[model samples]
Target: MPPVPQQHGHGMESPSIFQKSEMGAMMGGGVGLTIGFIFGSWSIIRHGAGPRGFMATLSQYMLSSAATFSFFLAIGSVIRSDSPLALRMEAMQLQLSASNPILRSKAESAQIVRARWAEERSRASN
Candidate 1:
């Protein structure tokens, strides 16, 4: 009878630190803009006790709305690729794992190589 191979321990490789920072910044900016919009609009709506104040408030509201829309539009344009950040992260992790010495054993290395080849073939096919 053949002896069973010992199982190796390998944690998944992590995402690129840069991509994570970018994603965090993107999300943070989005949330900050949302909060700003809400508070700015509230302040405009609640304190317009005279015609001049109301006109000024209305003008500010329109400008704010336009600016917010443009900012998000720019972000949408920048991230227009269908490949999401999570997918990019997964590919990076796979690449790092495939290259790392600690994760590369004879058996595991062979398996990783075959898997990578298969992935490439499929990608080429598509």
Candidate 2:
């Protein structure tokens, strides 16, 4: 094949690693907040609040919020732990593990997988 003309002379596009990780962490934090709100509001309402109950509710809310924040914080740390290089390595690992033959074979045994793969393959060949 003829070599494609280069825009930046073969240099690849470089996205900021920190920004990408922040986005994932923010998404995880949103997920955690959603979980907390869905579960925590009901918990407070169900329990009701007197003076001690008020304190208890505040405590629970703080605990739940903290839990949510920490969960996302951990996700960010994992994603950006070693900069752009580590992130690429982790992505490669995920792709390899997810496509392993043993796992794929097990999935193929299930009727759902058979139907899905057949559909996908047929679609692709078109």
Candidate 3:
């Protein structure tokens, strides 16, 4: 029996909470910015900017909306909750365990290469 590549024991790890939070914040900020721009433009057309000036008022709206959304979203996964890295590792395991000799060999070799590269990178970083 061949040895199975265990995803859990392997050096591969799911995205950290911080990474997830950052992703959510980025997504929310972008969406909020777009929405803010649209609403600000409409507001300017309908009511006109006060003495604060059009650019100033528009920017205030954009920044406020972006900050509000990013803060809330960063607290939790507002858009993406799953780690893509986990998904990739799962897919790789399927290939590595495939009954087809060629596919298994390729997957095994790829896994070995990646592990070696990661080791080297860690060494270099230190």
Candidate 4:
């Protein structure tokens, strides 16, 4: 096979929930900061307040607004992403989870529970 050009790198783009959500949060925070600044400024202009204490309060409000927007946008983006839940998990989760001792133990416990449930069902039937 002929070596593909450097620009035409492998086209397999794995969609990851964490990456998508982080991107969404950053975008949302930027928007929220702009909005909060405008609103906060307008509010101060209307109310007519002190420069020192009032400005401090206004800055706090802007930061809070940015945080709130970031949080909700992150969750909303995750929910609205095109990928199915299973695929989303596959992309974001560490590949080592399968070999991780904690995960393996949890999986084993689930199997034991399934076996017990199957036995119960069989006994009830008989």
> TM-score for every candidate vs. truth?
0.30, 0.39, 0.52, 0.54
Clashing pairs in 3: none
Which of the predicted structures, 1 or 3, would earn the higher TM-score when compared with the native?
Answer: 3
lDDT of 1 by residue, 4-26 (tens): 74332464344344454455556
Clashes of each: 0, 0, 0, 0
lDDT of each residue in 63-84, candidate 3, tens digit only:
8888888888888683455567
**Per-candidate RMSD, Å:** 14.8, 12.6, 10.9, 13.2
Error of 2 at 120 (Å): 13
Model 4 misplaced regions, further than 4 Å: 1-10, 50-54, 84-126
Where does the lowest 10-residue lDDT sum fall in candidate 1?
6-15
Error of 3 at 101 (Å): 41
Backbone steric clashes in candidate 4, count:
0
Ten contiguous residues with the weakest lDDT in model 3? 1-10
Off by over 4 Å in 2: 1-14, 50-63, 66-70, 73-126
In order, the Cα lDDT scores of the candidates are: 0.60, 0.64, 0.80, 0.77
Compared with the true structure, what per-residue lDDT tens digits does model 2 show for residues 1-126? 466743433576444566556656666666666666656677767876656765566566656775677566757666654455777887677767856523345555697777988998999999
Across 46-86, the per-residue lDDT of candidate 4 in tens digits comes to 88556666778688768888999999999998887765567
What would the C-alpha RMSD of candidate 2 be, to one decimal place? Answer: 12.6
Q: Which stretches of candidate 1 lie over 4 Å from their true place?
A: 1-12, 49-126
CA deviation > 4 Å runs, candidate 3? 1-11, 78-126
